[model samples]
Target: MTRKTTNSLEEVHESVAIVQNTSIWKKILAFFGPAYMVSVGYMDPGNWATDIAGGSQFGYKLIWVLLMSNIMALLLQSLSARLGIVRQRDLAQASRDTYSRPVNMVLYLLAEIAIAACDLAEVLGMAIGLQLLFDIPLLWGVSITMLDTFLLLFLLNKGIRKMEAFIIALIAIIGLSFLIEMFLAKPDVTEIARGLIPSIPDSTALYIAIGIIGATVMPHNLYLHSSLVQTRKFDRSKKGIKQAIRYNFLDSFLALNMAFFVNAAILILAAAAFYKNGMHEVAEIQDAHRLLEPLLGTHWASILFAVALIAAGQSSTITGTLAGQIVMEGYLNLRIQPWVRRIITRLIAIVPALVAIIYFGEAATGKLLLLSQVILSLQLGFAIIPLIHFVSDKTKMQGFAIGKWTKIASWLIALIIVTLNAKLVFDEIETWVTTSENPIYIWLFVVPIAIFAAFLLLYIIIKPFVEKNRTIPNLVPHINEIVVSESNEPIVYSKIAIALDFSKTDQKSIASALQLGGKTAHYTIIHVVETVGAMVHGNETHDYETTSDHYYLEEYQKALEARGYQVSSILDFGSPKKSIAKVVNENDFDILVLGAHGHNWFKDLLLGTTVDAVRHKITIPLLVVKDH
Candidate 1:
């Protein structure tokens, strides 16, 4: 019976294998297509509207936001790329696995809502751009955009590279249109140069500047860029990985630099055309275009502005769709049909936008843009904090982690963003409660609520360390006893083991092992216990599994495979110390590598059973990687 079942399974697997093998190009293309689609989010029409508004209102006073945002973009994109490359998974997916279920659900819901909000802006921008270009009704234009689903499917089927090339072409057209507009307007080059210098005009301008920064960097783009990096199917060799990282950085830098220039051009053009003339009445994206008609010749200016808006809207929509996919896949681990996700996101976004449009009529454009930027600003912290923590953790990254200066810069940027958003939320609430004519008894309700929220945030910031301390003490010998080992043997083995539960220090240990080579050395990865405690034991299982031998072994094998290394794995149910020693002795391993602090070691050492057991029982060299 078992043989017959095995044969049936093999037959099914073979059939699927044949299908997958036949579509190698299709699979490769699928990976390449998403990044270009995702890149559009950076240069979306909503961003154009904000950039133009910022320029028209403040006249290059807000240029610093663009500069700062691009820098932030670079740092965040690098983190995203590293996450994808090192973990072989998207950020959302990682979060779902790492975080508590409640935390995961909350994050997923927030991200999903955020993505939907973003899609609304893209869809609205596209519909409006269409209306502007073709003199179609806004509602009709919106209805027409429903066809994007079919378009997306058709493009995906053709090949991702084809889609990327097409998007790049559109971007070029948009870039050219902006360049022509900038040259035609011919703003004072000196004034444009001055815009590059940083100075805050006022508190209100500061807030608006922050808004622009938030708008430009965006939360969804982080998810998109990381997932996009995975499309390269990067070679894991040291040199190859390094090269992949280099090219990725270059790609991101180029893409974002173009985004910077495009954003700056909009602002500079507006400043040159409208600001110098003391015209601050421009509200809508279309208004910015109309403002250009009087300054530059009407025919060329209107046409260029319309075309650029169209390009921005279409390109951004494509990216927004892709971002939605990454967020869904990463956070939920649900590979829902792409069209379903797209349509759901589009519908959510469009309903709010349509309501705003219907209610406010022409005034809705600026409000829609502002609302989108504000939502992005609010959601920034959720993504940014995780990014900072993950990248800065040396344990997770091994040698390919973020540098100290980069971490400092990342933290500073994240702090500034959090502060700005906090300030915005506070000010908005203050205005609503204190200054409004109908001063609600709700002030009694609002103050404590605000205080509680602040406390909650403070707690979350320190929660990881607090929890760590509560659960386990450091297992490393005192610093005084941690003398660097002096060895005559040339270190030949560099082994790295990756696991979901291991701390950053564990990652560093793996890196250290790799650095310390051994003669004919091989890195052995083992995951001993595979079955989840909930499935195997019951609700009594602690958050941190003491019996993760199978889990570790499986992950170790996977990491080895990812690095193109052959590894021997061991799975055992009993004491990890005994098992490890037996494996080491049997395999003739020269060195034993283990996390300085782990499940069995703590209890075993306390009971005087662990280190002694390994030291006496195993003949191989032992390396304990210390975690910071």
Candidate 2:
């Protein structure tokens, strides 16, 4: 594809051209990037090893696993893209702001670990592929893979489109290699068709089947997709956003379709040659390569297989490293040195992977792959649950948020993933206890402790809702006052009400609102509905009075007072909307300026009561300045 360079003015024209250019074929092509990016997970080195093993051991029967997994991947990737295009932010960042501190922290920690593990896999895959193709030592190849950090940063510096183009090109090479290999292998047609029909041969096949599904739709990909689509810089207009979303969906579909074909090809090659030949004991990735030699000419089979592995490893690593940056910056709102973060994460993950590779050597390939995927599966709940919560909450998302149907679908998928992980954890624990021939003290103590931990986790989940409901009633009256005061105004437009949230992005919005409104109106900063109960209960702190409140007030007061306008600061206990309304009703103001930060679609829709309630109930025209 030839790259198109254009400016903001040209972007509209170009975007229109893109929309007009759409046909079934064009849409199918556009779907390639997202699906290809997503498909990397399905065809990652770990997945390749497993797919090859599964097919060689169980023949074409396990091909159904890959097919089912692709369907689930389609559903999840669509949700991630929708969330990004609609909310205009990544999933991790959205969840961080919407969820409570402890919950958010827990989720962040788990997600970070998962991303690191994913990076580890990518690095290992690359290293292994290097060993297979170029005879480079694994440790040296791992170290060499660090250069990808600079490569990715360089690509991103050029712009997002370029990065996406590079990834798409890499996916093309991988896809082409597999297609050629499939044609050369020439597997049986009837048996390949039979593989598409789902049937569980035994418990082991079922477990591997589940693993295949779990491995395909990776959790970090959610973070990557959401953050990646944000780079397109589409116009904030409704039509423009809708068009961008449509194109994104098209991109994902094409990429995944290619991924599906590549995945199927790998399975078919293994099934045709190894399964039919009664190779039931194929144990490692290297073993599958040997089997391919007898079916296809040895040189072509080895070269194509190695090239595909190298492509998968390199492409997935680039994306995984980028995802780590997005997660850290988005969720924590912390901007660490990018290289420092990369090195830290890489070092942490490489230690365990290297130890296993060195200690168990080639024999541990299957174990390493399975363990990495298991870790990913365990961490998925942290990412998935928050996505469900943020998308469903009308308070956070404005008009563009997830609807009921999307919410239900997302919830069902999340639940199934969680259930699968839970079963894995439980079964692993049961096996450990049964196999341990040690004293009863070990089993008795460990079992109860695990049960208690699980119970505590459940309590923690329910506790937030209980506290929110209990405190909401008291806050209601204060909220009601703001709702009622929506019509009133002060004589001076100087006093501006800024609704503060835990999100640091709110600070940016507040800054912009004061700047825009300060030119025409003198402003007073007011933080309404400060919940004393939360502070007293130790759930929240009175530190807002000192930290956020004091800093912003001092900064704005200095800025306004210098400009010859009187400034006053108020931090009151009540609903923000009602308190602002009451203040407007009580004071004679020329106009009311409120800051609107576009965080979530539902939240944007209701204007957090401060803007919307005032707009609806107040007599004055509420000046809402949205910080992009």
Candidate 3:
């Protein structure tokens, strides 16, 4: 039997209801929460390293990079939301629908790696924040961060609205903390305004600028936003879809700008406090915390910074967990409990982080955080390119398809992301080759991986256009394509077989068979003796259990014969499924009837299900009657 398609986050998909005939403002308010959850990715701890590095070294010159990146994020996030609202499929599911299984597996693995990379940054940031505020040891703080798995479970159990409220509260704390810090730093408004003009001072500045773009326009957020927008239950009508698109675009604009504010505040505070003091080397989160008190001459400066760091880590981690669930469910159609998935994703990130902190010392976290953002940048194209192609398909989207100019602009954004990521990888690899004492590993390891990644990217980009002319077969036939038989003649069964165990459900199976075949058809009563002796010796064994089964079969046969139905009984030995299938196929039976106990999965796992097994082995139509 063909199964129905499920939603991405089936637990929360269409969980939020939009009331019809409501005020305009009330309708807009219903779509408010999804994009805010997505925006947390933008202001995650991964952004901190790039923003701090850019602000301190260039002194507000790289602000234009942040602006441009924010604009790009707005556009791409909107497109992502549009895809989910119209197609009702997340990015991973959509990819699985179009791409081959091997290609989908590769994409799934890449997405998993990106989430782990993002989580690494959050783990480090939370650890650093704890160390700064409570004087907790960094290693101990890292261990303590795992306890939030329970906190996420609590919020999720309360429902999506409560979860959104919890996240918004955390966002407000981060925003308010940064707002006060912005006032404390008191940056020069004119220089900040002048910094909006685009400029790159050096190669180092170019590297930091790409990091800013990577940090701001995160790849995971595309997979995230596409699924998140589906949480809201809206109208499926044309007017309803258009309204959902408009309101969600507004949500992305506002929420991402709020994220922009938090990021800009971090950079501006870094510039006004560090660069203005001639401290051009402040790149680490802990280093920034240490210097804030003395440079700003207020203890609150450092205190607020640490508080905001913890909140940022906490908020981003929650959304990261949700994104992991969506990707796993969409690509593989596999799901576990939310808390179980949360622990697994966290542990994958924690191992590398604990190793860096314990073996290389706490200072290693600064470089590790920046490396995480670069990893996210590398995986960006695999997500964005497919999304643009899916949304731009005129055949699938019809009237909702993106227009010609929007398609061009979407591709332009994808090109910029791919180009910047390529440049970043090339520059980093060149530096590694030049600086390494032995460059053979780079040729053997790095070069092959890069070539493979490039080929995969090229395949996804070019496959859609190539397959536009070719017909892709549908697994199930559509209603219009199926031929209807006008004949309404009744189905008549001449020879009917009934398989039964000696339980209360046995009568129901016999009754159903009698209803179908009536008195005119011949009835064959089949039973399998599943005793230990019968299993070992088959027809030769003469155990008490087998004798009892034979006696019960005779009683059933005599009762059916007394009702004027032509009936015969047969008792077989060995496995129930294999023996029953053999009896039905060897005889001239038109249909086989059996009883289902309606057991749960746990019961089925422990004691095997005979009905399920028997159905697959038999050739004729099998009818199942459930015991209430």
What overall lDDT goes with each candidate model? 0.64, 0.64, 0.83
Which residues of candidate 3, in runs, are more than 4 Å off? Answer: 1-3, 469-628
* Top candidate when judged by lDDT against the true structure: 3
State the lDDT at 203 in candidate 3.
87
**Cα lDDT tens digits for candidate 3, 1-628:** 1223556775566667789899999999999988999999999888998889888898989888888989989989998999999988899888888888899999999998988888888888888898899999989988987877778778766667898888889899999999999988999999999999989999889878877887888877898899988877777889999999999999999999999998898899999999999999999999999999999999999999999999988888778877877788778765455566678767877777798888989878888888888788789899999999989887766578888888898889889889988887888789999999999999899988998999999999999998864443343323222212222334378789988776656767777787777778898989997644566578886544566678767777876776677999989998887899999988889999888866678756544678888899889999998867
lDDT, residue 273, model 3? 94
The model with the greatest TM-score is 3
**RMSD, candidate 3, Å:** 12.9
Q: What is candidate 3's TM-score against the reference?
A: 0.77
Question: Could you give candidate 2's per-residue lDDT for residues 1-628 as a string of tens digits?
Answer: 1111111111111111233344756643443354555567667776776677678778888887788777777767777877776775688766654556676676677788887667666777788778788989887777788788788768755645566688778888888888888788788888888988989897667566656765677888888787666544445577766777777877777777777787778777777777778887674666776667776766778777888888898888877776776676666665344466566555656666677677888567666775676677667766766566555555444555677887777778777776776777677677877887874865688678556545544644455355433211121112112211111233344445554432333445445445544445555566553433222323243332334444544555565566554567665554566666776777665566666655365544423334666677667656665656
Q: What's the lDDT of the predicted structure labeled candidate 2? A: 0.64
- Ten-residue stretch with the least lDDT total in model 3: 479-488
- Tens digits of lDDT, candidate 1, 448-525: 766654654554455544443232223222222222332446656544232112334545555555556532345665
The runs of at least 3 residues in candidate 1 whose Cα sits more than 4 Å from the true structure, single-residue gaps closed, are: 1-38, 441-460, 463-628
List candidate 2 stretches off by more than 4 Å: 1-35, 439-559, 562-628
